[model samples]
Target chain A: MRSDKQSRTPMGLKIAAGLGLAFLHLPLLLIFLYAFTTEDKSYQFPPPGLTLKWFAVTWNRPDVWEALGLSVRVASISTVVALVLGTLCAAAVSQTRFFGRETISLLVILPIALPGIITGISLRSAFNLAEIPFSFWTIVLGHATFCVVVVYNNAVARFRRVSGSLIEASMDLGADGFQTFRHVILPNIGTALLAGGMLAFALSFDEVIVTTFTAGQQATLPIWMLEELVRPRQRPVTNVVAMVVVLVTFLPILAAYYLTRDGDQISGQGK
Target chain B: MPHAVTFQKVSRHFGSVRAVDAVDLEVEAGEFFAMLGPSGSGKTTCLRLIAGFEQPTSGHIEIFGETAEGVPPYRRNVNTVFQDYALFPHLNVADNVAYGQMIRGVGKAERLRDAEAALEMVKLPGYGARKPGELSGGQRQRVALARALVNKPKVLLLDEPLGALDLKLREQMQEELKTLQKALGITFVFVTHDQGEALSMADRIAVFNHGKIMQTGTPEEIYRRPKTRFVADFVGSSNVLSPAFTRRLGGPAEWASLRPEDIRIGAEGGHEARVTGSSFLGNATRLTLDMAGEKLTVLLPAGSAVPAPGASVRFSWEPSALHLMGTET
Candidate 1:
């Protein structure tokens, strides 16, 4: 009788999840529909005409291409920097016990929790005080500050899930410190790191408020969208670019989900 | 034979609590030694200290005739199979087994050959491609052993390696482990909370209580002539009789331990008792008898009829069967 109830529970959950997925995708589906509609001035549903003109126009615009390239560069650089620093911090904090360790972890995670505007204001003020020019590097730095938190959280959770005894066993088996880390720890945490890096990349690729303060003359994709929204000229092209960004970011999030789904099972077995 | 591992007055304290308190022990070369203790008795801590995962508060540890003061676990020439087996989840069995050899920078072909041989030795020849998760608990344990043994360290430390298995699997692994140790001729420092495991496998068992070594001896000596009350109670079942001296049997003593099997029923004997209860076990009937106002348990063979609940019965044992502990010393 209990097994019969247990089997029915998952079927009910599957139906609920199907509805939930439809709700989430409905908005994105509407946005994609408008991008293909020939109407350029309004966002009314059931448009009179549909065409691929916006995609062609978006491709022809040099300004849109420039913004796209700049967003790619900033997100790539920020993700790389965040990945290195976050992994190092996670490794240092996960295994060792020392004074004020909780405080250190909180400080690392604070940027993501606090309001983005506050982070933007602080970075803007700091850069102004230092008399540093805002450019690609400043946007990268601003994005990295918050992106590090994402990577750090994922990596630290992975590290904690890994059994300490596994590390000890590796060391006892004649593997030196570096060898143990390279062969044992790295492989165990590989999926977490990859998931974290993807999430960080997606976050940096679409960041706007922080980039607004840090980006002086250069414009990333999010900043470009904000500008396009405020003053409309070739508005359908902006929708096309928005669709592209959504697809690019959506794919990685899907990948991240798949990567992390089996992470707990892998770490849980040894414990 | 020379000692392979020695702990001289070693202690480990976690803040105010002494986890391992001033322990001194010596494990001889190629000997299968066991540190037997319950949880919080510090047997695992002692193994960790020997493995260099922790430093002793005071005293010295020597492994293979060399002082182990500043040496790390990687440099210790010892391997450990952790309580959970600690098999690498990411790697297949072959890669996990090859790790130690790779760390030593052994040639690729030689490492592969050695890893295959180790896997075969553990009775899992064709399981090289399976991940640790794919294997059952016993198979993962064998992989852990194969991983550790491929390196061929001077000593192997096992911290309750069979603890996670069911009773049937644990018993099987115990025999396999004993056979493997003999075949390899490597010193083993095994830690377990189960007295049965220690008694069945170890050449010499060190009993620990409250972070101290209570007694160390052969299983027979531990079971038959336990030095302390703790040792007597911990190793095997014994009916602790607080005998009021009506003229000592051998010498004046306050207390003596009598094994349940040693006491005989239904014969004119040394002690007067009334049978309070009798439980029919498979091979033996356990009788609870009241002797001189103290309850005593005796194990009688199943063929014997059990006495009534309140019936008076006479109990006796051979003089040598009585284990006396001095009252004051």
Candidate 2:
């Protein structure tokens, strides 16, 4: 759906954008290139020869499986928690009025606004003060804090776009409170919630900074990748795993962007 | 028999602004009643009160002799056709029309059957599968009407439901609505700011202004015998013969409303006037006359000689045409 206006963008601006995109994605392209490299000991661009060995090595490693499993579990749990808390918070903030509403909304988004290391340190300190042990749950709780903000940002924008009259019309047409929410309000906001949940999952999946403070003696995939980078065990296998990481995070964010891009026009607007 | 709707001194206020102020109204069963007013005139507020969307600040409402206090709109035996139609975007026409029945736990086969029947009633047969977005403005309006009518409520409330349509479509819907009301025998409470719409469709109309009802009567009674200056000006085209101007014309009344049609153009009447201006309407000529510098409008029927500006002419009305406005007006 490229518009005529977009096609008519100045040649200099288009070339500049192409250069910027190349600058950002060249490193990612290198990662994909090296995933097939035969060199296991030393790193070089355009590696001496290409082989399928690293993909097999990553698939066979028990340690890689454990880390991958933990990362998936943590992201799943965090996104679920975020979806519930974020959607309810969004509905309350957008649909109702109370004292400190703006302050509460600002506070909801505060965790994502602060430096991730700062959020990590405060969370670590809080857990230490409470005498809570760092386990799988702790990592999930830390990720949930930031994940909730992503979900909330998406949900609030969508909730505000829904017309109030639709809800009232539902009620007037003989739907009770819960019925109206199910039939009218849910249909209007369902796509937004799904998009928000996908984004939250993507954010939680690749999270590394907060996981550093909250996870003790447990390695999520990103943590595993960081340790393997320092220790350098079968380095190309790390590159292979990084490709997996990229795909897992990329798909949902792509999907979420598409979902919300056309979300402003909810069902049954203008013909 | 109980009236279809009744408001016993109802009022609704928002902070210091009185949206509906001490309104007492009744609509007989099976009557086509229209609440007519300008924006912020509290007519919409009154309709909302009956629909149970807004509870009265004081007093009570009765639907078919049962008090509407503490009743939700769903629990009330009435349905509303919203101004915007408010069709469910996700649902097709059948599912949308079947929503109330679905809420009542009716079976799929039965509700779908009823939905099709309702659509047929609105002359939209075989439109069950189409989305509301695919329909024209008039088609969406019919779907809304079908959705509300499927539940078979004792009363139907419409808040300017035809306002979004063009003039030709609106007039057509007006006739269709009147015929449907006659066939169904269900009370219809319609709200509109358009005066012509009320006059054409309503069996009786309540004219509202500043949160109070100015007058309530049949279309003819309200038009021919408006009690207040507001009603005289708001209801239709009428030249208010003020006392000072009446004295200049040597008439008896202090304040009276003279209908444009009542003043004949060339009928050899007593008073003399200079034709200041006129516009040719297809079937009639609306002549603007300056009666000793006071402006008066005369609606001369077709085939009558339309006088030019500055053409001196004689005109007058029978005593019956002068509707006086006493202090109560």
Tell me, by lDDT, which candidate is best. 2
lDDT of 1 by residue, B1-329 (tens): 55999899999999999999999999999999999988999999999998999999998999988999889999988899988888888877888899888888888788888889999999999898778878998988898899988888899999999989999999999999999999999999999989999999999999999999999998999989987767877887786655464234343455677788998876675667888998888999999997666777899887887888899988878888888765743
Off by over 4 Å in 1: A1-66, A88-113, A122-138, A216-218, A232-240, A247-271, B241-251
Per-residue lDDT of candidate 2, residues A1-271 (tens digit): 2864577777798899999999999999999888999887667866999999889999999999999999999999999999899989998999888999999999999999999999999999999999999999999999999999988998898778666667777887789999998988777788878887887887888889999999999999988988987875588888999998888678877876776666545353533
Stretches > 4 Å off in candidate 2: A1-26, A29-66, A92-142, A213-219, A234-237, A250-270, B247-253, B267-269
Which candidate comes out best when scored by DockQ? 1
Clashing pairs in 2: none
Model 2 lDDT on a 0 to 1 scale? 0.89
The number of the candidate with the highest TM-score is: 2
DockQ score of each predicted structure, in the order shown? 0.54, 0.53
